[model samples]
Target: MSVHFEERSGVVPCKTPWGSWYQTMEEVSIEVNVPPGTSAKEVKCELGSRRVELVVRGQQVFKGKLFGTTVEDEATWTLEDKCLIRIVLMKANREAGNCWGSLLDGQYSADPWVQDQMQRKLTLERFQRENPGFDFSGAEISGNFAGGGPDFSNLQR
Candidate 1:
């Protein structure tokens, strides 16, 4: 006989006389909402040159393949104490094209991680300009954290 293939939605599942094989699942766009009782320490997010992965309780829950742009090291994870976890990505280049709204897209390029970074940078600059009295001596100078972001949480003080 000949070989045949079937496609559905965004994936392909091939069925043969012996068994069946399914293709990889689609990239996860949107925010990953984990179940209740999830701890911050239990959740792990891995950011690569062009992709983002999330693992909770030892299981890979979400994955997002980004565009040509690079992501910043400082990803803001605005999570609750012991409930849900929320995060925003920071794109490297600010003068590029339109950024992706969601995490995953059917196309080759998903999203760009930039908004959060620019916002934080601007906010921090504004605050420092307005309140020069505020002491920022405890902050460390590192990778993308040269001057530091607006949020003071990262500061050691």
Candidate 2:
């Protein structure tokens, strides 16, 4: 797990129905890259064995699952605010190998979710480049930008 991120500023850790997560209220510089033809409304997320069910204000929106080898896990979807994705992984003392693995030597091709995540990340990078001074603190589905956001309901096929 080699996750490299710049020092985030004004970030506060918060908890949701799924688990504890963190976000920054300030415009922190996050060096990232996205794929081509991807829009800003998407986010590429990678997780472990844990799978999450998305809910908004107590309403169910989407369900998620992780795919990969026993050592690595990966998934992707559009970014949304106020939407929580619950990850369900553990069962009967058995661990689901979804999020922990060596990505360097792991399988990265032929995984639909991984591709989606990559596209979403690229979209985010483009969004950051376009909006040089805006904070991505509240970029979830609930929040709306001046131009437009990712169409979570509609994904590229």
Candidate 3:
């Protein structure tokens, strides 16, 4: 239940056992960490019934699960001194929202979608870093292979 961070995106997962989740009269706030120099446009957040996914640089990084309370779609995020992304989620059931367990203490892992997208994004980012000045965008798959099996179609987009 320790807090963990993915170095690639510098994402500090929310709702981990390490995070503090508390509810006020109308909202629940969770603190997260993002990379420095992360512009507002570079970060994309998606809220589901129980999970919150964050997409940065076209990479799915942090996916946090809200165990008890249902969160509203509209969320507010503010930047801290050293690139901390604080997200406050609106509680669907505000009156009894305080009846939850400890917020911090469980493993925080991204969802399957985040895993898939992050794999591709990290691979591309690594390739770009290793091969500077290479036109990765123009690179083509010759379509001629031994097995003719899975290709980089998923990695393309």
Candidate 4:
């Protein structure tokens, strides 16, 4: 199960048997693709604080523990185009900016590229926290970032 990482959206595509997933600092979105023309009534999705279960067409597609805890009450699932199931789960610890290594425990861990991006995000967040006067929201730190990035040391906030 190879996963394709999209740099712009930060989405890890199709690492699981069911589908793809992406995450923000606050929540995770899972996209499960079913056969075209499948009805919503035929899909059953169950979300818990540390687990998730999906059943399609009366057969269990996936059932496993999650990599991180989520707010069960805030989780939601919706059927799109009659074939795609979108699940959104709010993290229990959103303020921490914790990155999930994978959607399911012991399975589909993020690739090196994704992990690098996650670490970069975390570092940018820490820089923002340390220097509240500067906005790091759109900053991109790369190989030559130090040489090409803006000089903030002398900037007046």
Candidate 5:
């Protein structure tokens, strides 16, 4: 899989199923809206496509997913502006033989023993306050994040 940030939309893009086919789902997008008085280091996890975008406002935050089953495992913060956002998708098979369909969550967690959560949410507010107009992107839903896009250095890291 390949990952990078797009300049035009200020969002990150992650392409998967390298040199192969996965399913019918597209790429995912995760956008984090940085707020004020927040630090960049607070926010963890490399944002990808899955079309998941986490936005932070004054006292409320928004998060969602775009592709397959989403795991709820993630990072924790001590700040007040930070919150949890999870999106899960499942597919069920309908057959009448030994080879039937099954429903399962599709996500890789950071912990080897667990397959629930992966990344941690940071204080986007701090990052935004320090820098302005930070460009960000996310991963694709279920397809490869293919692109011949431009470089992203202007985005406030």
Candidate 6:
């Protein structure tokens, strides 16, 4: 099957032959869709600081080095409804406003649209950081802000 990715929540999910994944500032969530009635024992996941491997039904679905470091000890996975595998990985470097361009290193990178959204998110985070007293949580960014966006460095409350 061809790899397919969809944009959601201002980020593009990286779809793979095994499943799909998206990331937050502190975590990465992966969803592996397996056949119906598949048992939990059929799924085996190995997560490390910089690598991950998933095996299903005795078949290695995915094995690759992760794009960033993760706290493997804090990672968690669950088999839901006997067919869906949900995995959450905690990033070791939970730096504020940081974003990952992809799940796996040197592969399955985010598209341009997703990259733009990530840039916007980082900009908003900078705004929030600079203006601690103001809440930029509900701020909305629109239009093509690439290259030469507004400079709020001089703005004072």
Task: For residues 84-145, write the lDDT of model 4, one tens digit per residue.
Answer: 99999998976424777788887767787775666566556546655776767667777522
Candidate no. 5 TM-score: 0.20
lDDT of 3: 0.48
Reference-based TM-score, model 1: 0.41
- Deviation in Å, model 6, residue 43 alpha carbon: 0.9
**What TM-score number comes out for model 6?**
0.72
- Per-residue CA lDDT of model 6 for 1-157, tens digit only, reads 4221112225436677667887655678899999999998788899898999989999887789998899989999899999899999998876544567788887777788876766565555555556676665557788654532457557775
lDDT of 5 by residue, 1-157 (tens): 3232223223212212111111111112222334445553444432333323333343323333433433223312233343332222221211111110111124211232111111101112122223445522332222221221222348765
Q: How many Å off is the CA of 125 in candidate 4? A: 6.0
Q: In model 4, which regions exceed 4 Å deviation?
A: 1-14, 122-138, 142-157
Give one digit per residue, the lDDT tens place, for model 1 in 46-89.
76647767788898766667553445465555446555555555
What C-alpha lDDT values do all the predictions have? 0.43, 0.31, 0.48, 0.73, 0.25, 0.73
Worst 10 residues of 1 by lDDT: 2-11
lDDT string for model 3 (20-117, tens) is: 34333345566656677777777787766566776666876666676555556666776676466667776565432132233322434444544333
Off by over 4 Å in 5: 1-29, 39-58, 63-67, 74-157
Q: Could you tell me every candidate's TM-score relative to the true structure?
A: 0.41, 0.23, 0.43, 0.72, 0.20, 0.72
Tell me which residue pairs clash in candidate 6: none
lDDT of 6: 0.73
Query: How close to the true structure is residue 79 of candidate 6, measured as C-alpha lDDT?
Result: 93
What lDDT tens digits, residue by residue, belong to model 2 across residues 1-157?
4221213222232222333332111111112223344343443344334343433334443344423222223233343232433222222221111222112133212244443333333334335545567643235323332123353435554
Model 1 C-alpha lDDT versus the unseen true structure: 0.43
lDDT of 3 at 71: 59
